[model samples]
Structures are given as C-alpha cells and as structure tokens.
Target: MNTDESNNKGNIICGRCAYDANPRGATHCQKCGTPLVIASVPNSDPSPASDSTLLVGGISVVATVLFFAIGGYFFWQQVRVASTPSNLNNSADNISSDIRLYNSMKEVPKVPEGTFNYGGAVVFAPLRNSLHKAINQVYPKFGLRFTEPKYNNPGQNTGITMLLDGELSFAQSSKPLEDTHYSKAKERGFSLQQVAIGIDGFLLFTHPDVSIPGLAVEQVKDIFKGKITNWNQVGGPDLAITAFAFNPKFGSSLNILLGPELDQLSPKVQFMRDYTDGVRKVSSIRGALGIGSTGAILGQKSIRPLAIAHGNSKSYVPPFTDDGKQVNATALRDGTYPLTRRLFIVIRRDGTIDEAAGVAYTNLLLSQEGQQYIEKAGFVPIRN
Candidate 1:
C-alpha cells in the first residue's frame, strides 16, 4: 500500500520487528511498541554504510590474492639461492685470492699475452678450486680470461678426455695418462703433455657405526672388489660391506689402487657406471666404506678413516704408532695407507718447455704464497 494511505490508518510496517506501527515516523508502534521509519525496502541499492558487508568481502578476496603472489615469489627465490653453491661469497673470495697470488708470481719474468678464456674440470680435491683460481688470474694478467670450470664427478682421466673432445683447453687430473689415452691423442695427431702440480691424498671412511681397528693395503682392495663383503671380516661390525670409490674418469685413485693390487678389476668394478651413483649407493649402505678427496667427504659422519700401515720392509703393517695420531702423508706416500695419487694441470705446448702460460702457472703454484692457499684448502703442498 502507499505510504500515505497506510500511515493515515495508523498501520506502518516495522521492518525489524515486523510489528504494525503508528504512522508519520512515530516513536512507538501501534500494534507492538517498535520504532517507525521511512519505507523498509529502498528503490535502489543501499547506501555505502549499509553495504559495508559486501565491500569487506571484496577487499578480503583481493588481499588473499595479493598475499599468494608475494609468497610465491619468495619461495622461488629461496630455491634459486639454495642451488648455486659456487656463487657464494666465500667461494668468490677463494677465487680472488688465488688470482692475486698468480699476479705476484710473475715478478720472475712472466708472459704478457692477450685476453683469452680458459676453464676445465679438475680431479676432486679440497685445493682444486684454489689451484685453478691461481692459474685463472695469472693467465688473464698475461691476457687470458679463465672461464669457470663445470666439474663433473670423476671418471678415468676424462678431464683430459674432455680436452681431446675440444671441450676444454686443458684437463686437470690426479692420475697420469694411461697408454690408451696417449694413443687417442696420437691418433688425433697431437702430443698430450702432463704438467705435474702436486700430490693429493684419498682417505677411507666407515659408517659412524663401524669400529674397525685398522686396514692394510690389500684389505682395502679386497673390500672394494667384493671379495670381503662384510665389515666383520675387517673387524668393524657384523654388517655387509658396501664399497664406494670415485669414478675413474674424474678420479684416478680407483685405477691407481686397482691396477697394482689386482692387475685388472673383476668385470663388476671396471664397468660399473657413474661416480655420483657410487657416492649415493655407498653412503646409504648398512656398513659402507668410501674413498674420496677431503673435499668430497666434508660433512659425512657415515664414513670414517681406517688406520693404515706398512712395515719398515715391503710387507703390510698396521697403522703405525706415531706421536699418538697415526696416519699421515708419510704412510700414504710409502704405500702404507694404500690410497695415493699425483695431481697436475695438463696443458699443451703453446711454446717451449720454459715459455708458456701453463708453465708460468705451474711455477706459481709451487711458490710459497700459492702453497698457502693449497694448505688452507686442506691438501698437501709439495713446494714447502
């Protein structure tokens, strides 16, 4: 009914109470005391204050969308940072210091050449990067830019293997070239020169659960060859032995150890695939044993170093009694410890045996200052 007609009869509808109210904005209702106001339903949408609920709902949706977008961006950034280990500040600093040493070494009459790019894989060792960095900076001072190396898990001197394939100017390797590898270079109509850098050691590790008294050279080979497959055979625990060794391509220790000890590995050890897989499989095994560079086993508690020894003569000796702490470079070099290999920077002859960037870098590495980085990075220094 029309407001005017309804109001005159003293019957106004109360929207809130649904009671009949007196007409003309009465303070009290006629049928049931309730406030009277204008028409309950409006002709258009409600005013701003009255539509507050819908407005709040719209704002809430926008805020939720915005939050998700910001959250997603942060999550992606964290993943990126986690993956780039070489980009870390410490790694950069290590690179920079090596470069400085390279520059200083040139006072003895170094080459000044053009800017050129260089990089290649080195055998896995704590000092690998430092050695490379020292070389990289010096190469560039003579006008060569050393490209960052993308290290692959070791295989049989494939560091040089990559060089032959035209992937690198040189290959960094721990082991010397095999006859077959030399043949490949001969086939390519090029002579591969070996530049000796220094020596790097490999240490064997056992699970935190293992407690072997010590291991002799032959015992080590036996464990890896699958002949002695249980820790009890070596006095650790009564668990099966799962052995780990770096790939021959990236690391030469496997070949070094296998060659003299067993002549050639039983087909099982020779053909078994990749190095990373070996690390994974070995570390997870129940009573596992592993051999790797100091760099490779930094945080693993699952692997422990077993004592090694060689008698004053050629026969096997248990880890010796030194000044309480037993294993040292002497034992390793003497073959008392069993695992040892020489590391080097293998480069081609750009010039004479005396005049090349590679030769210049080799000399710098043996100097007192360059040897410091090598020592700090945790490797043996043949220089001093």
Candidate 2:
C-alpha cells in the first residue's frame, strides 16, 4: 500500500486501504481493490445538501429583515398620527368637554310665577343677598323676596315658626330639622322637609386681645359647659372666661357648636341676640369668647377665629388660612375641621304654591349655577 502518496489534486482515495493514487474518474482503488471516494473541489458548483442549507438560511435572514421593517413602519405611523394637528385639536376638545361636564348647569327646574316670601337664619343673609338676587335677575318671573319676622329677630327658629304659622313660604336653616320640628309640623297638619345645599362650619373666636392659638374639642365643650371657667385653664392669660353665644331658642348655632349637652352653660355665659350681637359683646369684653359660623366670622376684625384640635390629636386646623384672609375650604370639605354642618332649605310639603316655590328654590340652590353663587357667598357648594 502506498501510504505516503498525497491526493492534493482532484483525485480518488481508497476507502479500505491507504492509497491516494486512484484516477479522478475511478470507482475502485488499484492497490486494494476497495471502493474509492471522490474529494470535493473549492469554488466549484455546490452540492444538493449545501444548496438546501443555504436556501433555509436565506429565507430566515429575509424573514427577520421583513419583520423589523414592518414593525418600524407601524411605529412610524403611530407617531405620525399622534403628532398631527387634527389629533391635537381632538385632544383639546375632549379636555374642554370634560370641564363643561363638571360645571354643566343646563337643567335647572322651573318655578311658578309669583312673589314668594322666604327668610331664615341670618347666617344665610349673604346667600340671600347674592344668590337670591342673582336668581331673580336670571329668572325674573320667579319673584323671590326675602322677609323677616316683624316682632322678633329673624333666625332659624323664628323662620321655622313663621313657616308653621303660615307667615313664610319657605325658610333657610343652618342646622338640620330636629324631631321637635317634625312633631310641630305634624300637629299643624303639614310636614316640613329640608334640603341641604351647602356646607358650613362653626368657628370659635375671641377678642383680638386674647392670645390663645387653639383649643381641643373637649376643652371647648368644657368651657361652654361651665367646667372650665378661667382662660388660664386652656393655655391663656389668668382672666375670667366670659363666653358669649346666641340663644339656643333663637337658633341652633349654639347646639351645633357645643353639642347636645348645652343644658349647663357657664354661669358667665351670656346669650346674645344674634351673631352680630355676639361679635359686639365679645369685642368689648376683655376675656370674651364666642362661637359663630365660619362664613360669618371669617373676615371679622373685632374678633379672630381659633384653631381647633380633635380628641387627643395635637394638630390644630384653623378655620382661616395662614394670612387670615380666606376660609380654609379644603379642611371643611374633607372633614378635617372639627365643627362642620350643612345648610338647608326648609320647605312645607303641603302641595300648595308654597311647595312649588320651595321645591323650585331648593333645586336652583343645588343646581350648578346656584352652587357657583353659593361658593361666591362664602359657603362650600354641596354640588362640587
């Protein structure tokens, strides 16, 4: 066997013997009489196996390029659509529509055409002067007029009494109707209904000379309940605490401020005729303290509102802002303010023109336009 023979050129090699001297076209080895295998040439035409592999690889490469190209094209289309002026305008229009939806006031119900007498809590005087006047200007046919009790001062209790005595078509109240009101109304062969349309809060205020920053809710209750008699008891100067409040018979402001246990007010507690009277009295006395509506006492120069803390919490929230120029409406709406209540419209549900007028007025106050006026009049709108 020729073991050292080189088959560098295109020649055959024996499969069974170490022979490489077979001719290019031979099928058998000359030295061993065994089968011969042909060697492949470089740069010649490819075989079927090589062709099949190349075909599959080519298809894969083409498919990958096409996939990337299609994806890129769709992404470019999306970006183009998003940045177009028409789409931008559509987005702006959607935002405007959303705002309009929030402040829409298109469906205010109608009232009967006649002069109606309505009056109630002096706390609602601002709303009556502003929102009521605006309502008249907007709907001139609804002739809503504010009236007061001729014999006594106008207040929540007086207004409800007048309503029960057929002196008023409707009344505005700062507090909810109690069971006693329902009982009285039933005795009169008519029932009273109240619709809450605004949010209000009670604020404890004192003379400008008093330097106490705030008080705990329990401390306030105790002061009004005659348990705490000296200003020094609740972190103030050593002065006799003289508390002033509206008579509970005239209005429920005191009830809402001091809770239901108001039977034992301080011996020094003086009942004022109204909030204005309380303000005047408190401003004159050295150690005078008073509680009134946040809307009423917000901007008073003679007296200043005090911050209040709830339970054992030390964080005190003032009813006014830091500058003392505006009410802290966020706190009132979120219930962070310790003393908050609702303002209501009291209407007799006796199926008369008074009922129609009352329902219509309540609807107006709860409507979007009316709520705007309510907020303008320094009360939190019940709607928004």
In the order shown, the candidates' Cα RMSDs to the true structure are 30.0, 31.1
Tens-place lDDT per residue, model 1, 1-384, is: 012112223344544435443343343233222222233222324676433122111233245346546675664343344223332222211111012222245442455454433344333344556655765565555544444436654344555666665555555666666656655654664445554445555666666677766777677777767778788876668997666665554556677777765454434442223334545665566687776654344444445555554422234333323432333545544555555666655554323332255545554664556666655554555443
Query: Which pairs of residues collide in model 2?
Result: none
Clashes of 1: 16
TM-score of each: 0.57, 0.69
Candidate 2, residues 3-66: lDDT per residue as tens digits? 2222556445554445555555443344433323233333434675332111111233345346
lDDT of each: 0.49, 0.69
**Among all windows of ten consecutive residues in candidate 2, which has the lowest summed lDDT?**
92-101
TM-score of 1: 0.57
